[model samples]
Target: MTLSLNDLPLRDDLRGLTPYGAPQAPLPIALNVNENTHPIPDAVASDILDDIALAIRDVNRYPDREFTTLRESFAEYLGHGLTPEQIWAGNGSNEVLQHILQAFGGPGRTAFGFAPTYSMYPLIAQGTGARWIPGTRQPDYTITPEEAAEQVRTADPDVIILCTPNNPTGTPLGLDVVEAVYEAARGIVIVDEAYQEFAPHDAPSALTLLEGRPRLAVSRTMSKAFAFAGARVGYLAADPTFIDALRLVRLPYHLSTLTQAAAVAALRNSDVMLGMVEEIVEQRDRITATLEALGYTPHESWSNFVLFGGIADPRATWQQLFDRGVLVRDVGIPGHLRVSAGTEAETTAFLDALASIGSAS
Candidate 1:
């Protein structure tokens, strides 16, 4: 008598939903997730190991409950005049986001984001017992000031999330749209800037808009640009009061000693860890250009991945690429697929494999 999930009691809201994750296959060239794909330079890896070694010596005691030193290091690294008092972190950006929802969202409250954005937003809302509302985006995936403001005013949600350089679509949101949404809404506005390091240097970040806005938060992660995805470090910058609110819901000593130590060491070598961004951006642009030449419509992207359309059979093409020892994402968009920008050699391998599959037309 095997007990299946259907036979066991489960939460009503979660009973029918599938878990969120990309497909995983063992392939020689994997560009499915937007990982940095570059190994940490040897010197930096050695430094991180040394720091982790030191942290383990204190294993007999609980780690810092506040993770004070790690917060300070993050403040210095972000430097839009941010301070330790304005910082909050968790196991990953997802957990940090979960803390936000726990503090401000619950039954009768609603969380909002544009449709076709990160899939986790809705799942996180559901898990927190909040309703999820998905707004619309332009056909090209960009949202305008008017559309955003109107939607926020109408939804009047408890928490609003805006994903710049949106995942799966690679669309970049404008700051003006963010401002409009913030003004029209009565709740918190979170800007998920997971790919900020890959954007142009001249671009202004939502951090510039944080000083006077207490309900605004700009979240970042070391996963993409720092090649620290495995380190599980994600943080956000916001008002001290907002940070205090999260503290109420978070578990004691949420970040372990080893995690804090590795993140701090990586921050210490920020220049070296970030040196790969320029190269990754180059490969992203290369992918976009080659995609166009190959007769696909590659959407404009400021991040380290390219999402191209014109695929006649997305799943088959994905499988063909998989069979050829390369892996890319079939992100559920009809006639389209997304591929992360990898190392120079890896990028060539992906592009060559894609070429061999022939044009989607």
Candidate 2:
């Protein structure tokens, strides 16, 4: 017999929940999800292929649960004097976050973040049965250290999520705010810097603050910059003790042999792998500048995506782009929409489409 979710004895809180994702319909120009628009450089692809072949030779054996080599390579990439013992790896940054909340947040525990930030932060808390509390950001999509501290003091969350160059908005928070949040809360503080590679050169990473702050964890991914999203590698830099705690929560051999090999190859050829970042940054700047010139309010973006306000109807705008063979994100923020920075040609197409829409409006 057919049944509704309520008939399946699902958790009451999860009964009405829709899964989290942006629309991904494989449009001609897919700027909806914040993904790398560039294909892997030929040389790098060749190196990765050879490494994958080597890794698959031993596929019959269980992969390394420790992910030791990947962790060491990541530690070197992070370069805040991090040691392999202090690093942890998971399928994606999302899984790394789940491990964190599982370790520190639970039924009675709470996790907090600033609003107009990463939507997944709250959803991750819900998945772990932890209460999610969102504090407000400024009108410009930034939160002050004072405001963040007060929110932490009030909520007393067991985990704090700081999304640097935060998703959707792309606002980079200063380390001051991170420090304040860490000091005001009693639990683990996670600074999600998934897009840090796209930020301005001067943008500081929370990894720099890891020396004395054992409770502070900085999570990053090879997806955006390294163009390794398919590799499924995300990691964190924290104290070795905290890394040990994640050992209890993560599944055994979570990082596959092929995944490990791919990540290692990417890290080994870091220069070639990250070569598109500067070019992508150029496209992002072009998008921001063109949006500003068109009389829309493009919030300052340090990530590879731009979120622009002044959209009278974001759903209509999204549909308009979709109709034109492009797909951008309608991030539920009224009067605004987000578009990822793709190839220069993709950027021009987006601009030309928006210019048309504006003209007709």
Per-residue error (Å), model 1, residue 354: 0.9
lDDT of 2 by residue, 112-215 (tens): 88897888888899999999998888899888899999989998889999999889899989999999998998989999999999998888888889988889
Q: At residue 148, give the lDDT of candidate 1.
A: 96
- Clashing pairs in model 2? none
Each model's C-alpha lDDT? 0.93, 0.90
TM-score of 2: 0.98
Model 1 clashing residue pairs (backbone)? none
Provide the lowest-lDDT 10-residue window in model 2. 352-361
TM-score of each: 0.99, 0.98
